[model samples]
Target chain A: MASWAPTVLASDTLIDANAVDYLIVGLYFAVVLGIGLMARRQVSDSVDFFLSGRSLPAWVTGLAFIAANLGAVEIMGMSASGAEFGLPTVHYFWVGAIPAMLFLGVVMMPFYYGSKVRSVPEFMYRRFGTGAHLVNSISFAVAQLLIAGINLYLLGTIIQALLGWPLLVALLVAAVVVLSYITLGGLSAAIYNEVLQFFVIVAALLPLTLIGLDRVGGWGGLTDKITEAAGDNPETAPAAQQLNSWPGNALSGFDSDLLSVVGIVFGLGFVLSFGYWTTNFVEVQRAMATDSISSARKTPIIGAFPKMFVPFITILPGMIAAVLVSEIADTKAGEQVAGGTGGTVTYNDSLLYLMRDLLPNGLLGVAIAGLLAAFMAGMAANISAFNTVFSYDLWQRYAVKDRDDDYYLKIGRLATVGATVIAVGTAYLATNFSNIMDYLQTLFGFFNAPLFATFILGMFWKRMTATAGWVGLVSGTLSAVAVAFLSEDAFGSLSLGVIPVGGQGAAFLAAGAAFVVDIVLSVVVSLVTRPKPVEELKGLVYSETPREDLVDADEASYPWYRRTLPLAGVALAMVVVLNVLF
Target chain B: MPTAPARATQRRHRAGALDIRNIIGGLLAAYGVILTLMGLLGDPETDKTGGVNANLWAGLAMLVVGLVFVAWAVLRPTYVPDGGAEDPSAD
Candidate 1:
């Protein structure tokens, strides 16, 4: 087994910071602390701390909804992917993200917000039973810890490489900052900072892209340079189809047979996307913080608009790095350049290289601040989500039943600290994985894909019994594990006659298979068992629920075209245009 | 009649309505001003991106937008609902 180690940078390669850079970074930290302190006064009870008292507006919740997902891994991994895979990587944003976000806003929000469930696991308890709730709560808690650790690990590694600070020191500073704010102000502070971080990320990335584009000439210039570089080194040439978003022949476009159009559509676009964006509590918590049902329903739609354009800043820089950072024969053993020949390109260091090579001192600080903001936002999001599930779903339900609001609130704060500590420990474990993002997606397949299956059956099919919910969830998760173990690539154990899709593609397929099994088992078991009465299933199930129960009165006043559907239409149109253009 | 405890609770609720937009706007404006100043007055000889000082331009733009958000927050303060939890099943 590979041991955990931090990615280090040579002292000479570190960007020299000036007075202005330090000032910018200092100001950024001060503002974040100020926001946290300000939000501290708002938490008077458990609801206030855990759910922001459900008082945010559409725009605030909307931006934060997307921001929570924009972590260190996202910034670094997506850029690395852009350099490695080219335009095809944009699928993670567009097809893999947009539709699902829209679905959450339009279809699923009514159930979550209308029912007024404090968290996703609470909803599982109401719809399924204690068994399903426990399964989800435990799984979600574990996933959040792992994800938090991954964010911390990536942040520490990046900061160490950029500032030449000890990895442990960097991790400590991040944990202290994140823990202080989250413990003091709770989810409100986390959400407020996430919105702020969104703007900072844009500010940091857009400039690098513009400057790089100017130097390269234009988009055409970037492509030409890449083509030239690939031409010189026949061994490193990207597939002919990599440059285009969607080639005329799907099979010919991808470097591997694993990236089939069918897999991208069914596996990634439907199962993984819906499972994550719709059911995952980390994203849904933002939407649930909205003041009214209408705002809650609009939150993900609002997020989707900005989310559609994020690739320009996030992915474009990597593409530029691919062209500009040339292959150099480095004498140092520890130093790995972005696009080096013979020596491996430290693909994870792509974003750091862009900031160091492109920006001046003052601008460099803003960029570094932006990177810090993303890391903090990501860590805080997981901690908040973890605490909520631990306190409300697990502790309240199992350990300390019938506790007062104050008791629960106290537990929530303590849980935040405890989760943060565990997460810090998990961060050390992250170094074992080769690619953090791929590992994260595989974990999602194990838990969320099956969870979404149960959710779909519960919400849409009223006949789904509580027994079926537990059985489906367990069976679906098992099927996913089976597929992973059976796949020749993932475990290299057994054959299921399934063609070898690469890591990401295989994960997507496993999720798809799990979804199918969940739906089938749920339907069969539910039919055989007794079903709940229509009255009992009122707000929980769609068929029996009244239209007014699902929608806000204010939203009903608007015409059909004036609502979120138009936004979805516009987003879909843009996706089509991008696919064609690329 | 409204009791002393009820009035105190209302006061706490009112105080809790800290407009998050105000915080966002203030922080952006602060950072924007600093970056803008550096872009305008900092070392000109070390022209990294040829001649265009992106820090100054982006900073000014962010400053204007942040100020607009601040102005909006002041002009139309967000209303705080009563301090109470809803019946989860009421809908």
Candidate 2:
């Protein structure tokens, strides 16, 4: 087990920053707060607060969709994965995220947009009744809080590392800044800031990646050095395994290459990815904010273009850090290094160490600002999604049935503040796990995998019943929890070690178990129960909805780029190219 | 009196003034300016980046992209119909 230590790094400060660096970070904060104020002018109602009034353009929502997912967990966790496992880490993006994103855009979005539901749980309520809806809403809210805490934790650590502030002070400051913007303008503030952050993040990381690559010669040089390093350390993965993306045993934590491939494809790619991109309200909310149904359909498809290339800037930097930074290199070589957010250094410090080793002052400021923006974007996405579900899905639906729109809007705002406060507490919970991905992937298995199973089965199979929905969800989640507890080190010391695999492989196993269990229970219970009537299933079920309602009739009149199919086609071809080349 | 299309175009221009592109452009340009100044006058610290002026190049790139966004917002602004239906089910 990786020893858990003091939450804050022992070192005084990781990155040295002068006044100019502070000025740049300050400018970024000013611009972010200014955007929040501007977006406040646009929010007058609950709908505006929750869904950007459903009036944003496709391109804006598309960028926000990717940015919301790009939060600090993605940046830090993926880099950590990259440093620990080599090229195989790209599967999380190219294989795991893109296809599922494209599927959300093309296959499921029509049902969501056409049905005119405010959130995913509302759709569940429509299809399967109150039981499934309540189950989904409560679970989703809890998951968002936990995930938000993870983002908050990373954000605080970055602040602590940069300014040498205590972790608690940094946490409070980060929480307040996020709470301020989200409370002021609601989802509009979050989305607009996300759009800005997307660019800032690119500006920050792109230079770091390029500079790191230059320092290590180039891509070929990186490969050669990695092979040499692997050769020197018998404890590390083979040079071939570190360099190749296929048969990812190191990433999956499986001894057999065949099991690793199966685990990644079925577990991570099919179940977990689909569960997240298709059903998670954080990403779906961005797509739902677009003006027209066609635009909504195109949002994730557009996001897919950038999603495929994210590995280069995110994961490749970790790969570079593993080679270039002496501390990261020593850690990877099975040697202990000191001075990180944890008392002892781990792979999570790869990106920070790289920035310290390279990057001059001006660029360092940009990088710091970028990391802050990413974490805020991540936490804001969680809080905003949590508020929407809390107000519209759980609190308003269950406790107060017939309130005014204004009352619900107030509730949404309160939920945002409440969730943020709760998140600060949860952030401490996140410090136990050194590698955030392990914590996160396990959560996805428990929440998203089973939810995806219930959603997909109910959406396509018209005969699925409401009783089946709630039953399947409860069982699937329990089974996943059981599997995680059984897996080695998945639950820290609580893990029973019955399942031999650990880390991401255990996550994949748990997700697969959840998906299978949910599907089986839903099918069995559905057979014995009475299904919803055909008359009420128009937009909710695939067979009942007319083809005409699923697509925009006017799309053909526009240019090819404006149509959903053509856009999705281009995205698919590009992702295929990325998968093949890398 | 203006033609219908002309009036529509004018309305679009009004919405365009409130476009997010302007904010993105303004901020990027502001950051770009500071970084560019730092690149010119402040310590280059070329040794850290293996003899590259990273700040100058990154700043210039930000400036160019920022201007492009501003130009796009001005040239082909988004068209949001006046008081469009806020409710999705109403359509």
Candidate 1 per-residue C-alpha lDDT over A488-566 given as tens digits, one digit per residue, 9 for 90 to 100: 4443334463655555666777898899999999999999998777687877899988999888888767776446667
**Model 1 ranges off by over 4 Å:** A1-13, A234-239, A247-259, A327-345, A488-499, A558-562, B1-17, B44-47, B81-91
Best of the candidates, TM-score = 2
DockQ of each model against the real complex?
Answer: 0.24, 0.33
Candidate 2 chain A: worst 10 consecutive residues by lDDT?
Answer: A1-10
Model 2 has a clash total of 0
- Candidate 2: tens digits of C-alpha lDDT, residues A170-222: 99999999999999888988998899899989999999999999999999999
**Cα distance off (Å), candidate 1, residue A6:** 18
Per-residue error for A496 in candidate 2, Å, reads 0.5
Candidate 2, residues B1-91, lDDT tens digits: the string is 1121122223343663247786677667767887888889888888888998888988998889878877787787766655632564432
